[model samples]
Target: IVLQNCMDTNEPDSDGLTPLMHAAAGGHEEVVGLLLSHGARLGDRDNRRRSVLHWAVLTYREAVLRLLLKHAATDDPLLIDAYDESGCSPLHAAIDSGFEIGVSILMEFGVNI
Candidate 1:
């Protein structure tokens, strides 16, 4: 409900992570969808240059990962292929973090190897 107010859904917090990133990290699939619907930038990255997909994968948010993937347009491969400060793509992060489901989902989405 608060999101329905005149608030900037893309506003980043002190950590440079927007609400969509937070929701993705916490596995809040519904909230992530809501934020996206509100115009949250799917390609928005944090201070580390990690996209929302990275946050979801890093935290093992399988459902959120899938949701983000489904919403990503063909031209939005950058979201799946983004590399963070540590030089890790969401796929790399998923593998490193042992998010097995995420790895498969990311691959299924055609994320660059």
Candidate 2:
């Protein structure tokens, strides 16, 4: 129904979060796959310039992060290095949040330290 309605996949909510971001943050891998298949923009940023990858890492959504990385634009450095208003990269967020698995996953994906 969401795709049939042509809902703006890139549109942000009041919190500057798109559906992709929310799905990734919540570790909803199936939803992430569905959204990506429906042409959801991987490069969309929140008001803080944070991408869905940032949300995934911050929330320790390892599976979602892996799914996102697979579909993310290879040319877009922001997917790995996205910094929020506080200048925290996805890797930094993982490390700061004490999510060891998240940190390792980001590192495996070759995120800039």
Highest lDDT against the true fold, candidate = 1
Clashes of each: 0, 0
- Collision pairs in model 2: none
Clashes (candidate 1): 0
Best by TM-score: 1
Candidate 2 residue-wise lDDT, 36-99, digit = tens = 8887888888888888888998888989988787676463645787777888888888888998
TM of each candidate vs. truth: 0.93, 0.89
| RMSD to native, candidate 2 | 1.6
Candidate 1 lDDT by residue in tens digits, 1-113: 54868789999998899999999999899999888887888988898888998899888998998999988855375677888998988889888888888999998988887
* Residue 69 in model 2: lDDT: 76
Once fitted onto the true fold, the runs of candidate 2 whose alpha carbons sit more than 4 angstroms away are: 73-77
- The 10-residue segment with the lowest total lDDT in model 1: 73-82
Report clash pairs, candidate 1: none
